[model samples]
Target: MTTYRDAGVDIDRANEFVEYIKEKVKGSFSQELVTEFGGFASGIEVKGYREPVIFSSTDGVGTKLKVAQELGVHDTVGIDLVAMNVNDVLTTGADPLFFLDYIAVGKIELETLKKVINGIIEGCKMGEVFLAGGETAEMPGFYPEGVYDLAGFCVGICEKGDVITGKEISPGDILVGIRSSGFHSNGFSLIRKVLKDSGVKLTDKIEEFGKSVGEVLLTPTRIYTREVKRLKSQVKVKGLAHITGGGIPENLIRVLPRDVRAVVEKERIPENPVFPWIQQLGGVEEREMFRTFNMGVGMIAVVSEADKERALEILGKDSFLCGYIEKGERSVKVI
Candidate 1:
């Protein structure tokens, strides 16, 4: 009989892969995660909060995965998967409780898949989320050999009234931005396109960044979970924005109250050598650069004027009071 394996699908191997992944996934479980891996559904107990608010975010690593494929590095992309989702949930003052990943591949090699899962575990640990469960699809014809795609779903929780949705954003609210460790998984399509057009190989090293293009591009997405989780307890975060595909203005505006605007000082953005180097090499315009890249500021917190000093003191060197809010159209003016 011509069975399922004839269609490039190995049911036995898929089950074996699940067992392999389940053991690794179990390492991230905590008391909050009630469901074990390999279950039809995952469950979390929401016992503590007065009115628990569940926050969820889903995202992928974007084109930065190309760098990983080129360099044969599979580990860090798993962290990128977790970061993209959990970081978004953190913006809402929620504590990430658990994460689920979706990895689709052509053919599953045990070693490469292990590295990916290991990185995911590391990321969940960093973000304080339990690796509850996930789905893996192995379709040989759909994907190229050794090529895979990753995405994840992260669910977090906070007290109902405690969610920081930027409704309180007003004039004089300080814009405290946290520094990014480089590109942080956004805008890689542009980066790759620019490099390819310039005939600049990923291995090429220039004077500016002091690292090869691939090295800069492959820097894993930062998990600001620890910092933001701490701040959730001590500070009143009126607004939070994760700098992603739309860059500052677009993402920041999502949390800004209507009739308010953020005035960012361009000079205050951290001295990120990678951006200027890429700009010069690609001859990208200043405005285009800001709209496309993080420009060194990855995450931002908008807080009340009274808490500005306290926030600065608590945040220490990781935060920058990049600007203040003003009464105007909902806009961001980088002066």
Candidate 2:
């Protein structure tokens, strides 16, 4: 008689895998999480907001996963998954409450999955969000052996009146640019193509960068939750933008009002070695580079001239006054 295991799906192994991850999932829980891991659905309690506005975002680490798979590194990608979603919700001045993850793998590797889960838990701690629950699917034949993909969903809450939608953004508002750790999980499609065409290996290290290609590429995306939350409480932040796939120009424009433009002073953007290296490797142009990568700036906050000092004070030295809003049609210009 044929059994399910013969068809590449192992019910017994899947059950054991779930049991294995239960404790790892529990490590991320807090008082807000209302249900255990094996429940029908995860539950969270929303409190402390007089008029709560729920903010949710779902995102996945894109082709960047290829780097992790190639290097046999699974942990940091989970942090990238959480950062992609939680940082997006944080754009609206919300405090992330909980996060859920989805992992799909060709085969269930307990140690590998555990490393990924541990990274997710670490990311949850960084963002101060509870790891409410997640799903892991062992789909053989659909994906190549030893390959997996990760996606995450994050939910946050904010008072209705405290949402930073950029509606209040006006001309002369200062644009504060926060430095990115590295590539931050975007623009990897081009990165891989360039590296492959140039015959660059993951272990190859350029003297300027002082690290292997894999090390720089696998760096976890930074979580801006704490810095942003603190800045909002201390300053009048008229608008906020999370720079991701579209880079500075595309992402920053999303939060600009119709009548104002963001005039970014490119020189003021802190130098990150990765962008210069990528440009040299790919022979990419200045505008295309800015259009495709963060180019150093990851998060942008617009504050009035009066509050710029306090905003910078709260954001600390990792940030700088990179630009200013100008009276123009709705757009962003890098000059």
Candidate 3:
């Protein structure tokens, strides 16, 4: 008489976990979420637009999870999961409507999963996106004990005519950079390699950080949905780029028109101590650092020089005049 539980898949515990999650995250669901938790699929209403364009994005936290898992802190990674997905859809000037997550682990660890879910709920509230639903998978052999992975899916809606394409970006357009909240879920493979080879411990604290390496590395990614939404309402944003794994040059060029070039004043990107610390510690080159990490600029907005002042005002003190579009080939130059 063999049972699923005997195979390390506890169906009973999974059932209880579902019920526990239902109780924990109900408040985070938005008014537009028509379906309740534990449903096979969730539905959301897209109202307020005569012609609505739906956009979506999916992302994960990458290897940053290793640091979180090693530190026994499961909450912040969930926020990273939401920020990565939500910010992508926001690049298109869309309003994030709903979100779903997938969690896979070797065993059903109640304490760990609870913290992860709570973080997701907090992220949803912060981003104003509804927590529609998600899945929890128990795979014994596939994942090691106490180890898990998370992925998030986001759906956003925008008015069809209002979609922001870089087509409008031309020479003399101003580029505004919104500061990042640390690395924002990219470059962890290099981060880990640097950590291992450079001989830095998570518990170690440097004068600049004022916190342990673990705490700094585990910082939650910033969600720009709110700031972007407000900016678009007033300013004529020609293009927007969400700086992620590829950093500025790679990511920003995607929104550049073929006939122009963007020259980023690298000196303009606010100084973040962690980046300098990593470069000095690992002896990494400046070019590779910009290509791999955000280097403190998380999002960039392209606007006509006329709207530049208004855009900066909306982005507030954290924003800076990072670059300007010019007539040249379709690429970004950070000098």
* Candidate 3 least-lDDT 10 residues: 27-36
Candidate 1 residues lying further than 4 Å off, grouped into runs, are 206-210
Candidate 1's displacement at residue 254, Å, is 0.5
The C-alpha RMSD of each candidate to the native structure, in angstroms, is 1.6, 1.2, 1.0
- Maximum-lDDT candidate: 3
- Range of the 10 consecutive residues with the lowest summed lDDT in candidate 1: 28-37
**Which ten-residue region of model 2 has the weakest summed lDDT?**
27-36
Measured with C-alpha atoms, the lDDT of residue 123 in candidate 2 is 92
Q: Identify the candidate with maximal TM-score.
A: 3
Instruction: Give the total clashing residue pairs for model 3.
Output: 0
TM-score of each predicted structure versus truth: 0.95, 0.97, 0.98
Which lDDT tens digits does candidate 2 get at residues 1-335? 89878877777877877776676665546644665457667667666779999999999999999999889899999899999999999999889988889999888777888888888889988988888778888788998788999999999999999998999999989999888988999999999999999999999987777889999999999999889989998898889899998888999999998989999999998899889999999899999899999998889999999988888889999999999999999999999
Ranking by lDDT: 3, 2, 1
lDDT accuracy of residue 320 in candidate 3: 93
